[model samples]
Target: MKLKELIFIATGLLVLTSCIRKEAPNQEADILRCILPAEILADKSIDYSLPFDTELKAYPIYIEVKGETNLSNLAPQFELSTGATIQPASGSYQDFTSPVYYTVTSESGTEHRPYAIIIRYKQTEQIPTDYHFEHVELYDNYYIFYEETDNDGRFTWASGNPGYALTGKASSPYDFPTTISPDGYIGHCAKLTTLLTGSLGEKVGKPIAAGNLFMGKFELLNALGDALSATKFGVPFYHRPTQLTGYFKYQSGPQFYEDGKYTSNKKDTFSIYALFYEKTNEMPFMDGHLPANHFESPNMVALAQLDKAQTIETEVWTYFEIPFDYTRYNLPVDTDKQQNGEYYLSIVFASSKDGDEFRGAPGSTLMIDEVKLIYE
Candidate 1:
């Protein structure tokens, strides 16, 4: 063996080792960057639950991290309990094959948050699906509502519970304006009723609450920031809605008010409506506070508004169905949004039709059951 040749090979190996040492840590050093923002879980592309170590099983979660494609690049630094451990540890990669639960250490190392991470990737269907609102669980008195997924878990059902929670003051499910009713034509129904806010509400000119449930989330942080901006509505729906069918019983409260001032004696009327919108492909979501000018939105693809005459206080669970009135169509009539489903479907229910503007009676109520989406 030539000593000169051997020396050249050893030098090359040393250079290669140095390069690998420099690159490996760079790829894995972003442990802090990989921590998903709390908002990412709210979007329902993933699922999250509380109370770690529950027997109830959750699966197929995809944790979303902005700008980083490889989740394994940065692992969360979690201070676990006795015998609790985070897979792959900090600064490692892991496939979210199951739920991840841990007590996250505070930046100052003084405080911690216990979280159980679960994800059920919503596989977008090319066909129409029905929402019966039969499945519900009590979480924070908000009733984390969802439908069963094919994998035996749940697909996320976003609601306006956060809006009510802003005023709930730790109220129980029974006390919430939106609660699951034991009575329904099928299993159980959603009951939405207006609540009279006491002194705290009076100060902010928010004296009454019109019960509401929608297909999207309620931005609680923004609910008080701007009530109009609080309601983030919609779901990624592929099919254009032909009609919406559901049973509802409504009764208007006697006195009407606007902005904490006595306005009129008009009866409060319930509203059941759906918005089919072609969202910007780049942004794919309608931010909170959009329902204020939804009708005039550039995203308006279709709208189905219930007739006021049909929502009288029947008290008997009456049936009602309304079809979509397409003011615009970005796609052809016979198609779904599967070519690139960049649309959001929002089905909204409110005790008072004008309640979005804070102009409704305090005691108005609406009970909804067996809601289904009929599509083309």
Candidate 2:
């Protein structure tokens, strides 16, 4: 059902009704919901980075629509990448040895956006020996993980960079709370910080955002509609994990706020946990629903959670280890080589454990270093 075609059918039926009363309700549709690349992908496996680039040998793309689509009969159209051929002929394919550009036109024909495409391939070992967070790149003054050299850019981590941008804050980079701390226990380490939402966020009930570094892409559409749904967690990992160990230090901020109210007695706690799960054809990744829906998800294979009760005010880094308890969440597992990329694992550490619900204090900090993932 193309959007405009559906709209015509709907409008024709409405006209036939021939309401004799007051002027028909204004036919105008809402436009605020229009956004870029509602969904763009070649396959379920390839990750998308809008204004995205790829290095795959063969690639195809798909795009969908949202909002005001019912207002026009025109089909969504594409400006195929220059100089390259595409599969459907109307679409695109590019050599991408150099950068490429493309555009998509809305069905309504009133709006359009250009997308930059880059195609350069670099291969990498499925998993790195260690993710020291030693190598980093700066974007908007915030640091993003770039651990190794590969054609694809070896940043396996994802943060709330895009959501924070909505706050209209010049310091939005800090909102992602991804920074390089020189005081790392080792040479350099990853630092994740939570930030207070700016004026724009408070208007929407999202008063604050947790500092999160997870293993998958963040969906912008979900971020706008529901914050929880936006936190898509986990990336495909083939190997079975035995243990997760890391060093961390956390300090609590002075005040606590929740749902537009202040509380003096309540103190925010931190959360550090790992989720190991299966990726069947049905279930792909966990999202913001994890807190409320985790137990019901059939894909849960194992879960390991850090159980620190209070903030450790110590100046020195503290060591903690959480052994994987697969049976606690799901049935026993077997080692299968074919299972590669069929399972997903994610480790998350937060300064405010309740930050997911938009509750937390400012200045709360958590520092981690020398993390190790031991597999059996």
Candidate 3:
């Protein structure tokens, strides 16, 4: 190569090297200077059973500066992406309260990618206050009583068993191997609505008769209908009473009997009930379907109404009663007082089987109204 060309190429390479040197140092400075708050394991792995103490609503958090990069004159701020709060750090370590959340900010008075920490709280034995529905009655015994009236202008029909929606009609089951359409039993329907009342003692020891065979516990029937057919000398399983919580809205299960059953010629029996569950979408903590079980939380009973259009509204009255024995079953700390734990209510139904059998058809609608919690 010519000497002139060689000199020109060398000069160009030197200029390029200088630019690269400047850029590399700046990049290195960022890596060495950035500050991160703290880190914790992601939520799905968190065990909810750890011990914890009850605080107001929020917890205080602190963070320690990890490196000697000297992040002085800057304060750190943290935020949860959802359902969490953070107070100003009073010290070097970040402190956090439950429930868990995300994100932390630096107090450098500048906007940069903020450091983050995973905050976790150990669960504690502080039992939460519970809501109990102690006593329930219909209309304070003023409006209508089932025993006094023969029919009371009530009927049970199966509008495809599942019944109708507010705007559009949904498809429900019909003509199953043991199913019928739109049950219209007089005595059975009365029993269904009647199951929503009475003293606390009657429901304590064993399961009782529930509402009509066509209508089931609200817990089991939140958004669907049911059908049943049973033969009876005593009560069949389908006619047994069930228990449910207040969260349930509607349900239907029907029953029917065979011919030539009872010697004395007694009619069949049927019912349903509502019970409570501790966790949402999990097995019920206490279910009325099985048998009478002791519980600390009071149960609520509602008097609801449903129009022919299947629109339901009912006024619910609450009662608070502590069981004679509440120390068992690891109940909440305070049951003697009213406002301690979450109150729950159960709705139940029942029925009896005789010599012959009874049958329940579809399209039976039960409407509840104005259900409210009266906390003490």
Candidate 4:
């Protein structure tokens, strides 16, 4: 072969190698969805599918049973990322009375992810009044507030901390949007602060995270894709609430930000409200996307919301009381449904009033303590 021809062949081979190196391998090993077969469920009519938390890599399945239900030797199906495989195999029977751990291997076999499958029995329990903002625990380096019921039952408060964890900005429990503060009206209180979610949050169109505490669960499955729908609000309540009273201290951040930009004219505000609504098959629960008519929704039995004027920035601890207005509701309260645990009530608090729209000022803080719900 000619010397020039040999050199040309070598150059072509070098270009081909460079192209191969540029193509990176996929490293995603995640569970997209989980479904439990109807045969394993005590109530065949109930859906036993679990919501997947991408950030936490866990599936918390709640099953409704009349009495004790068998959780052992039950196969659960899982839908995983493309080309990913789960150990113990999908649809393979395994004990689930206790949490079961599963490991997933990526298609490229270069990465692995561990997931926890937690099985919980669903039960309706009435919430206690007069929260002193006391009980809290640390989970995966983040603060989780919970309440101890009179019956020795534990009720955990849901917050935006788990969703904020997806940003990978928080370093400690205190760094999270929702956390505990030592400076309470009496003891430790629940502190909510709006914080910037950094580049990752901006990329997903959620530039800021507002500190919030609510009665229901935070569905992180669609958090990155649809944040508004991720917040499943309300829990079953048997009693009727008349008023909501609470003590709070608030301080708005220096600059208000909206849609990832600073808005000079806008001032930050806080939100404190409680909703009493009917739980029907059509509308099982409320979410961050509140109805346009607000209290006019047919499902809304009553609402106790702090007035906008009362949400102004205040350095001193302020006590506020709001009465639930049931007059706006056209239908009479169904005593049968209330006793059957068909009614739902949710009390929500947030650092920024418009946080659900991804508009808020970072550093805005709201500390809540001594919350009580007056019953009828």
lDDT of each: 0.63, 0.62, 0.24, 0.82
Clashes of each: 3, 1, 103, 0
Query: In model 3, which regions exceed 4 Å deviation?
Result: 1-255, 258-284, 291-343, 347-365, 371-375
Worst 10-residue lDDT window for candidate 3 reads 231-240
lDDT of 4 by residue, 1-376 (tens): 6999989999999987777455455688877767675544432323223445454566444445433657676677888888889997999998977778888888889888777776555565678877877988787668879888999977788888888988899999999999999999989899999999999999888999999999887877767877877777888888889999989999999899996699999889989999999988788878887632364666888889999888878898999999998887855789988876778989999998888778888999999999999997
Range of the 10 consecutive residues with the lowest summed lDDT in candidate 1: 24-33
For model 1, residues 29-118, the per-residue Cα lDDT tens digits are: 111222444543324233222122235332122454433233333344433333333334643544444556444444334444445444
Better of 2 and 4 by TM-score: 4
Order of the predicted models by lDDT, top scorer first: 4, 1, 2, 3
In model 4, residue pairs whose N, Cα or C atoms come closer than 3 Å (at least 3 residues apart or on different chains), thus clashing, are none
The alpha-carbon deviation from the true structure for residue 104 of candidate 3, after best TM-score superposition, in angstroms, is: 28
Q: Give the candidates in order of TM-score, highest first.
A: 4, 2, 1, 3
Better of 3 and 4 by TM-score: 4
Give lDDT tens digits, candidate 3, residues 119-190: 433221222122121212222111111121133432121111121121122222211111222221211112
Q: Which RMSD values do the candidates have, in order? A: 15.6, 11.4, 21.9, 5.1
User: By lDDT, who's the top model here?
Assistant: 4
